[model samples]
Target: MAETTNDTATLDCLIAGGGYVGLSVAVAVKHAAPHMNVLVVDAAPEDALSTDERASAIAAAASRMLGQLGLWEDMLKEAQPINEMIVTDSRTTDPVRPVFLTFGDVNEESNEPFAHMVPNKVLVGALRGKAKEVGVTILHGETVDDFITSDPTSEITLGSGKKLRTRLLIAADGVRSSLRDKAGIRTVHWDYDQMGLVTTVSHERPHHGRAEEHFLPGGPFATLPLPDKDGKHRSSLVWTEPTANAKRLMEAGDFTFELELESRFGHKLGEISVAGPRKAFPLGLTLARDFIRHRFALVGDAAHGIHPIAGQGLNLGFKDAAALAQTIVEADRLGLDIGMETVLERYQLWRRFDTVQMGLVTDMLNRLFSNDITPLRMVRSFGLGLVDRMPGIKKMFIDQAAGRAGTNPALLNGEAI
Candidate 1:
C-alpha cells in the first residue's frame, strides 16, 4: 500500500495514470534517483488491472529495460517468446493462404527471439509491485482533475478536492487523455473506421512460438502465441474489421462468432475455441503536436497513439518512458530543474520524430492492406516478396521490430540512467 501524501509538501514528480507507462516512469525515476519523491495517481479502481485479459508484445529492447529494472525475471516465467513470424495475404474465405514473408530469429549471432507475448495483468502487477518496492507512492481510485503550472511547480487538484504540488507532472493517461486536453495539447487525429477485436483461444495443438499475421480485405488478423495454461495450448488474437462488422461479430453468439473466426483463422492449429471474453477497441491515429509545456510532459498514448497493425503501440510507450526518465534523471543529477521547458524539450525532440515516422508507417501499411484493389494488392505483394528475398532488407526490418535501430536512450539499451 502507498503512503498518504501531505498536501503542503511538494513532490519531485507526480504522475497521472498508473498503467504500464505511468508506473514505469515512477519506478524508473525513483529507482535511479532515490532521493526524488514520486507519486502516481490512477483513476481506475485498485483491482482494475488484475482483470485485464488482453496481452501485449514486449519487444527485445523493452524486455531488456525490464530486466535492468529487476522485473523481467518474474515476467519471463509467463511470457511466450515469438520464435518466428509469417505474413500472408488472402481473403477470409480462401481455403489456402500463401505466406508472403517470413522472419526467423532476430539475428544469427544472438539467436534471441525478437519479442514476447505477455499478459497485461502480469505486466501491470509486476510494475505495481516494483513501484511499491522502489518507494514510489501510488494513489488508486484518484485522478488529477486539473492543474495550474507555475514557474517551479504545477499545483494539481484531485477529483476528491485535495491538492498537491509537484516539480514535474507527467501524463500517461492513455489515448483519450483528459490531461493532455487540459494542457492545451492539440493533436493530428483521424479515425480508421475500424475496430480491433481482441480475445484468447485454445487450440488442439501448440503454436510452437510462431506468430501469424494475415492481411484480409477488411484488416489484419494477428494470432500470437501464448504460454500454455493447465496443459492447454492457447493463443492471443487481434482481429481487425470495419466498425459495423466488428460490433456485429461481437454481438453474435459464440457459435456464430467461432464460425466467422474460423474463416480467418483456418485449421492451421487444428480445432479451436474462444477461451476468453471478446472486446473491441476502436482504431485511430492520434499524434500530439507538442509533447511538453511549462512543467508538464506527455508520455505513452497521451503523446501518440498509432494503429496496432505492427504490435508496436505498447513498445512505443516504453520508449517514451525510457527517454523521459533518462532526461529527468540526468537533469536532476546536473542540478537543473527537471520540469522546465528547456529540460522537457530534450525529451520531446528525441521522441517526436520517431513517433511521427512510426505513425505514418503504420497508417500507410493499414491503408495499403485493408482493401482488395487488385492493383494495390499486386504492388504490396510484390513489395513483400522482394523484401523477403533480400536478406539485408529483412534483417533491417527485424532490427526495427526489435527496437534496436535508432538513437536510443540508455535505459532502452539495458543500461542504468
Candidate 2:
C-alpha cells in the first residue's frame, strides 16, 4: 500500500502508460518484491484496449516470460502458433512469388514455435488482469502532467490534479513520449516516409499457421496467421506502402481496396475479404540517447521505436520490461535505491547496444528491400537463399528470433527474479 502524507501518496514506482510494457514492469516488480507499491497511469481511457483489433508477433522467449508472470494460460487459448514462415521478394504484379527462405523447425532446446500471433486486445487484457492480481494499482484516463526528480523521490502531478511521490518514475508512453521530453532526453530519430496499413482478413482456406512476408517495391507485406474465429479462417496483415499510396488505399472503396489487396495477397489463401476496420501507422525509427536518468527510466517505445520489417518491435519492448524489472528487483534485494543512476546504468548498458543494433538492422532492411533496383534485389534474394541452405546458420537465426540467443534477464529465461 502507498504511504499517504497530507494530500500525496508515495509509491515504490510510478509508471506512465498502462500498455503492455508498463503493466508488465508493474507486475514483475510487485510480484517479486511484494512489499513495494507500484502504480501505472495512462492517458487513454480504460476501454481503449478492448477496441484494438491489431495483432503482434510474440517471440518464444517472450511467451515464456508471460507464462512465468502467470498470464499465459488464458492467452494460449486464443494465440495462434506460427509453425512455419516463408519469405519472398517479388513485384506486386508478379504472377508467382518464389520463396527465397523458409523456416519450419521449432526451437531446439524448448521445442516451441519461434513465435506466435497474439491479438493485441488479448495480450493487453491478460497483462491488465495479471497486474491487478499482483496488486499493482492503475489509473485510467489520467496522465502524468509533470514530474520533479530529487534524489530519493520523484514527485509527479497527475492530470486529475492528484499528487504522488515515487522512488522511481518509468516512461512507457509510446514513441512520442511527453515524459521523455520533460526529462530532456535526446533521440536519434528518422521517418521512413512509409505507412503500415494494418487490417484483418477472412480467407476461404485455412492458413495452417504459416506466416508469409512478401518484399515488394513499396515495402514488406506480411500475412500472419491467426486462430479461426467462428469457423472463419483469418490472418492479420501489415501492408507497407509509401505514405501517399497508403492514404490513397485507405480512402479507396471496399471493392477497389480488395481488388488491390488480392493482387498482392494472391489466391493461395483463396478469396480474401476485409474482416476488420483498417488502420494506418506511420513508420519511423526513434532511439533514445540514454535509457535512464536519476530516479527516471524509459521502456518500450518510449525508449526505442523501429520499423516492423522484422516484426520484433513488441518483442524488443518485452525485453526491456524483463531487463528493467530484473535490475530493480535485484537492487531492492540488496537494500539499495532502485532509482539510483548506478543501478539504472546496469539496465541501460544491458539494453542500449541491442536496441541500436536492431534499429540499424531494420533501417537497412527497409531501405534495401523497399525499392525496385535490379542488382540490389538479385543480391538480397541470393543472400536469403544462401541463408536458407545453411542449417547451422538458419538455426542461429531461429534462435535469435526466438529471443533465446543472448545474455537474457531471468524473466526472459522464464526464471523468477
Candidate 3:
C-alpha cells in the first residue's frame, strides 16, 4: 500500500504519527512554522526500516529538544552521555545499602551531558534528516483510517486510499491513539502490572558515563550507559519487572538469560553480555482526558503515558514538543489560531502541571518500589540517606535530573525561538 496525494493544496499542518512523538511533532511544527505545509504520516509495514526498535531516554529535557532541533550535533556520535545517575537499593538485604538516587553533574553550567542514550533509530534519523532539510513532508506507507473537519481545515481518509485536506491536526498518534479514537478523545488507561524490558549489554567493565538505578522488589531496574562495539564497555537495559517476571525473563535460556542479566547488571558492570535483541513493553498509566479538541492537538503517546521510572518517557514528549512549539510559535506571531482553542489552551496550560507532576512522581515510584514494604521500606530508605547527606539537597537532586528544573520551554532550554 503506497499512497500519496497532494493536489488540493492549502494545507499547513497534518502530522499524524511517524513515531518518536510523530517525528518530533513534525519537526517541532516545521521548526516553528516555516511557511507551513508540514505533512508527516506513518502506518509502517512497507518493509519498515527508517529504524527504531525502542531505546529512548534522551532527557536533559530531551537533550535540549535535540539541541533545539538542530539534531544534537549528529546525535552525539552514537550517543552515551549520561554523565551520572546512580540510584540503587537493590532489593532489601539492607545493611544500610541505600543510595536511592544520585544524578551527578549532567550539565550544570556548560559542563554538558545530562542525558543522551540515542537509538530510536538514531533519534529518528536526526529528526528525519532535519525534516528533509527544512521541507518536512514524510509520507511513509500512509494511515489515518478516517476523518473530517472544517472551520479552518482537516479532512483525511486513508487506510491506504489516499485523501487529505488539512489546516491543522496533530496527534502524535501512539499509545492507542487512532487519531485519538478518531477525534472523539477519551482515555484514562491503566495496566502497570509492569513490563519495560529493553536490551543491549556487553560489558567487561565500563559504563563510566554512568546511570544505574536498581530498586528491585520487581520493578525499576534501569542500567543505561552505552557505546561499545567491542570498545570494551556498554549497557542499555531498563528491566522493570513483574509481568510474570518479564515473561520469565523473556523465556530464559540465552545462557539462562545471560545469567539473569548478569545478576542485575553485575553491580556496576564487571560482567553483562547480551548485546541486543530482547524487548517487551507494557507498563502504563495513560491519561488523555482531553488534550485539545477541534482542529486537533495531542502530542506524544497521544497525550501522556508516564513512568519509565524517571527517564520521563521521552522527557515527557520533549516537554510536549517544547510546549507545543512554544504555543504555536507565540500564537503564530500574533495572528493566533495555530489550531485555536486559544492556541490549544497554551498546550493545556503548559502541560497540565508537568503532566500531573510527572504522574504523581511515577505513581509514587511505582507504588514505592513495587512493595516489599517494611514501613515504606523505612521511609524511602531514610529519605535516600537524607538526600545523601544533603549537599544542598544533592544539588537539588542533580538539578532536577538535569532537565534543569521546571518552567523551561525554549525547546527545553537548548533554545531557539
Candidate 4:
C-alpha cells in the first residue's frame, strides 16, 4: 500500500538495511560511479551500528577490498592480526587436547597474515564514515515499508511517509529480510538446533595473535585473538552448543559458567575470565532461491545465511557487496539499464555457486563435529590428522581461509570496477 509519487527525483540505487553489508554496497557503488545517486535506509537509530560489541574475522582478500575503499588504514589501528591458527578435536572434559592441524603465520609469497580479527564497531564506523564522505544519502531511523517495481523505475515508501523513486532497490536487511519477502523471493532454510555463545575473555598470558578451534561434542569452539583491552590480554570466543544447553549456560552463575569454559578453553592461555556480557545467537542456514527479481536484488544475509563454523559468514557477505557493486557500476558505465534482467542475471551467475558451496561446506562441518558418534568422530579425526601431515593440503586450506581460491570480482581483488 505505498503511495506512488513520481514527483521525487529518482535515485540510481536505493539500498534497504544500512548494516555493514548495506553500507559497504553504498560505498563501493558511489566510489566507483560518482555520478550515480545512491540512498541507504535503515530501520535502526543512527547510533545502533556502532553499538555492537562483537568482533569478526576478516580474510586477507576482504581486507584488500577495504583497503581499496580507504577504510583499512583507520581500521588497522584497532585490528589484531591472526598470525596462526590451530585446530583440535576432543571431548568437553578431556584433560588433554592435541592439535591435529595448524596454519602458519604468513602467506608464502606476500608474507601477509591470512586474516585479522576486528571489532564490529570499528569496521561499521569506518564504512559509515566513508559512505557519508562520498555523498551517499542515508536515512536513519527509517524503514522501507513497501515498494512497487515497474518497467523503468521502482517507487519505495518509507515508514515516515516519504516516498522515493529508484532504478534499483537492493535488500541487505538480514536473514529474515522484509524487503526480500515483499519481492516474493523464496529461500531454502533450516535451523541448526544450536546456538553460538559469544563473549570476550581476558587471559593472564598473551595469545600472540593465535586462534584456536576445538571440535567438541556440542559444536566447534573458537578462541579468536583480539587486541588487549585496558592492559589485559583478550580473545573473542565463539562457543556453539545445543540450543537448550546454550540457554542454560547463558543463565548459569558466573562461577559455573567459568568452570565450563575452562574445561573447553584449557590452560594454554593461562588463567582466563569472561571479560564482557555473554550473548547467544541461534544458528541456521538460509539461501535465497533467486538473487535478483526485476529491479530488486538481494545482498548479504538477505540472500544467504550459513553456519558460522568456518568463520566466513561476514566475508561471504562482503563478497556479495563487492560483486553486486561491480555488476551495477559496470552496467551503468556502459550506458545500459543497470536494473535490467540481463545485467542482474550476470551477478546471480557469478555469486550463486560460491555461496551455495560455502553454505554446504559449513553445514557439513557443523554436522560432522557436533556429536560424539565414535565411528564418525574417529573418521573426522583421522581426516584432520591426514590433512595436517600434508603440507600441500594445509596450504590449500590456508588459501581458502584467505579467500583466494574462488573466482573473485575486480573489487574483491582491490581493483576498480
Candidate 5:
C-alpha cells in the first residue's frame, strides 16, 4: 500500500475509490484549477487496471471530456466507434430476430458517432497517466475507514490508521459506498432480480462498427462492437438473464455455455467463440437520497446506480464528475470555499433531474421488455416501430443518447473547465 505519514495540511479535495469516475474527478479538477491539491484513495491494488477485462461504452459527451483531458488521442488508438445500432425484440428461441429500431450515423452533422466501445484498461491507464502528470496523488490498496466533517474541513482516517484533512471529501466508492453510509446518506435501492453476464467473443466476420441489442424475455442481450485482433473479428457481449439462470450459465462447461450463447447471439456474426473470462454482476437501481452533506459529496455509482438497459451507467458517472469539477472550479475562481453547501448544491441541482429521468427510463424499459407477456410485447414492439418510423423523433432520441440533450458542462462540451 502507498503510505503517507499523517499530515496537518488540508487538501482541496479527497476522493475515495479511484475507479474511472474518481480518477476523472481528480484529473478534471486539477486541469481546471491547477493549484488545488487532490488525492485519490482506492482499495484496489496498484495493478488492478491491468486485470480489468471489461469494456465500457463511452458516450459522445464522455469522449469529448476525455479529449479535453488530453487522453482521447491515445484512447482513440484503442477505441471502436459505434457507427450503427440495431434494436430487436424477440424470444431466445426465436427463429428470426427482426430489427425494430435502428440508429446509423444518426448525427451526420456533428460527424460524431453516438458512442465508442473502449477497453476498460485502455481508458483507466490513460486517466491514471493524466492524473499523474497533473500532480494528483493516487494511493492504491488503501481505504478511508472513517471520516468526520467539521467546521472548515473534513478529517479522514485510513484503514492503516493514518489521518488526513481535506476541505471536501468525494465518494466515488461505487454502488455500496462505505463513505456514503458513513456520512449517513440514505439510498433508494431495489434489485432488478436479474444479472448481467459479460464476456468478449471472437467471430468469423467483422461487426463493422455495428452494435446490436436483442431484447429477450430475460432482458436485453447486447452485442457491442470492438476492434478486431490478428484478423479476427471481436465484440463484447452483455447477456442478461434471471439470477438463477445466469449462475447456471456461468457454472456451465465452456462448450455448454457456448451452445447457449450461440442461440441468442445468432449466426449473423458467423461462428463465434468466447475470447475471455465470463463474469456476472447483479442488476439493480440505487439512488442516493441526497448528493451532498456538509463537507461531503457523492459521485458516480456512489450517487446513483441505475439499470444498464440503456448502457448509460458509466456516462452518467462521467456527467457527475464533469458537473462537480465545474462547480468546484467556478466556486474557487470566485474566492469562495469550494466545499460549502451552496457550491455543492449547484452540482446536485444540475445533475438530479437528469439522473432521476434516466433511472425511471431504464427501470421502465427493463420491466416492459424483460418479460414475455403477450400484450406487453405487442405494445413495446409497436412503440419501437413507431419510434423507428419518426425521423425527427429518432434523431432527437439519438442526440439524447449521445449526451447532447439538456444542459451540459463545459468539460462535456470538450472545453476546459
Candidate 6:
C-alpha cells in the first residue's frame, strides 16, 4: 500500500534485514527456485562475523525443514540436541518441593529430541553460504533508505545509492521493522516488566543434553546445553527476571553474580561458572495486524514477535521463511505474479494462526509465572503435575514440540521448508 522508489530492474523478492529471518527467507526461496533473483539488503557492517555468541533454539519442526534444505547436516556439527526438558517452579522452596516435569518422545517418533541449540552466528553462516550456492545475491552494509511498489514491480533504494527491483518484497527486518512501519502496517505490542538475561556458563558435570526451564518468580530461567571448550560441559542461559533485577545482575561482579546463579542452577550442572558476557533483551510481544498488502508481505519477527519462554522465537521465524518460500514457489509454478495478492494472502493465512497461538501461550506462561501469587502458583504447578501424569495430555505437548499437533505449514513439517 505504501510507495517505494521505482528502480529500472526488479527482483523476485527483496528482503530487508540480514538477520536469521531475512537470510532464511532468501535461502528458502532460492532453494525452491534458483532462477528467481533474490537479494538481501542488510545494514550490519561488513565486518560482522558469522559466529555471533547469541544463542537460539531451533524447534524440531524447524530442524526438519533444515534437513530438507540440506542445512541440518551443516548445522549438526555445531548444534546441541535437547533430548529431554526439565521444568520446575523454582520460586517456591517448599519441602514438598516443586515438581520436576520431563517431556519425552512418542511412538514412531524415534524418541528424538525436542529441539537443538544453534548459536546465531553459525546458523546465519550456514544460511548465507547456502544462499550463495543457490545463486541468491546478498548486499551487506547496505541499509534500506526507502522502498515502494506500484503494480508490476517493487523497488528498493539502499543507503549505498544502489537499487534493485523485485516481483515481491518481504519484510523480515524484526520487531522494530522499519519496512513494516513504513508500509503503514499496525503492530500490537506490549512489553512485560521483565528482561531476559542471556549468557553462557561452564559446568562441572555433563548436561546430558537436557534443557532445563526454571519458572522463577520473576520469569523463566532456561539453561540449554552447549559444547565445552576444555572437556567441561557448558550451557547457554536465558534467565528472565525483573528489569531492575536484571540491571543489578548485569552490573554485579561476575564472581558475585555467578554465586546467585549457582544457587538456582547448581544441582544439575554441579558447580557453574559464567562462560560468556551477559546480554539482556526486554521481553515483549509484537503482532502485525496485517501481514500482506499490495505487492508486499512480512515474515519472521516483522510479522509477529512473541515471548521466548518456550524458545520458539526463531523457530517461528523459520516457519515463516519456509511457508513464504512455498507460497512463492507455487505461484511461480502457476505462472502468477510472485507479488500477487492471492499468493501473499496464502502465506498470511498459514502463519497467522501459528504466530497468534504461540503468542497467546507464551504470554500466558509469562504472566502466570511472573508473580508470587500463592493460589496461581499452586494451580500452575499442579497443572504441570497433572499433565505429566496424563499420557494423552503430555503427548499433546510432545506432538506440538515435534511440530505435529497443530495445523502448520508443510515446510515446518519437513516437507519443503
Candidate 4 lDDT, tens digit per residue, 236-309? 99999999999999999999999999999989889999998899999999999999999999999999999889
Judging by lDDT against the true structure, name the best candidate.
1
Residue-wise C-alpha lDDT for candidate 3, range 1-417, written one tens digit per residue = 113465465566777788777777778767877887777877774246544444666766677677777888778888878787778775634444456667677344677766778777787777878887878877877777877877777778767766777767888877788888878888887788889888877777777788878787888788887776656676778888878888998988799888777666655456567767898888888888888887788887788887788877677777787787777777778887787676788788888777767777888889887778688878877888778777787876666666678688887777776
**4 or 6, which is superior by lDDT?**
4
- The list of candidate 1 runs beyond 4 A from truth reads none
Per-residue lDDT value at 372 in model 6: 83
**What TM-score does prediction 4 earn?**
0.97
lDDT over C-alpha atoms for residue 402 of model 4: 88
Better of 2 and 4 by lDDT: 2
lDDT of 3 at 363: 85
Which runs of model 5 end up more than 4 angstroms from their true locations?
1-5
Q: lDDT by residue for model 1 over 264-367, one digit each (tens)? A: 99998999999999999999999999999989999999999999999998999999999999999999999999999999999999999999999999999999
lDDT of 2 by residue, 271-383 (tens): 89999999999999999999999999999999999999998998999999999999999999999999999999999999999999999999999999999999999999999
Please provide, for model 5 over 114-209, each residue's C-alpha lDDT reduced to its tens digit, 9 standing for 90 to 100: 999999999989998999999898889999999988878989998888888999999999999989999899989999889999999999998999
Name the candidate, 3 or 6, with the larger TM-score value: 6
Q: Model 2: which residue pairs collide?
A: none
Quote the positional error of residue 238 for candidate 1 in Å: 0.7
RMSD of each: 1.1, 1.3, 18.5, 2.5, 1.4, 3.1
For all predicted structures, in order, the TM-scores are 0.99, 0.98, 0.34, 0.97, 0.98, 0.94
Say which prediction, candidate 1 or candidate 3, comes out ahead on TM-score. 1
**Local accuracy of candidate 6 as per-residue lDDT tens digits, 82-128:** 88887888563533335557886663645557788887778888888
Please list the C-alpha lDDT of all candidates, in the order they appear: 0.93, 0.92, 0.75, 0.90, 0.92, 0.80
| TM-score, candidate number 6 | 0.94
* Residue pairs in candidate 1 whose N, alpha carbon or C atoms collide under 3 angstroms: none
lDDT of 5 at 6: 62
Local lDDT at 398 for model 3: 65
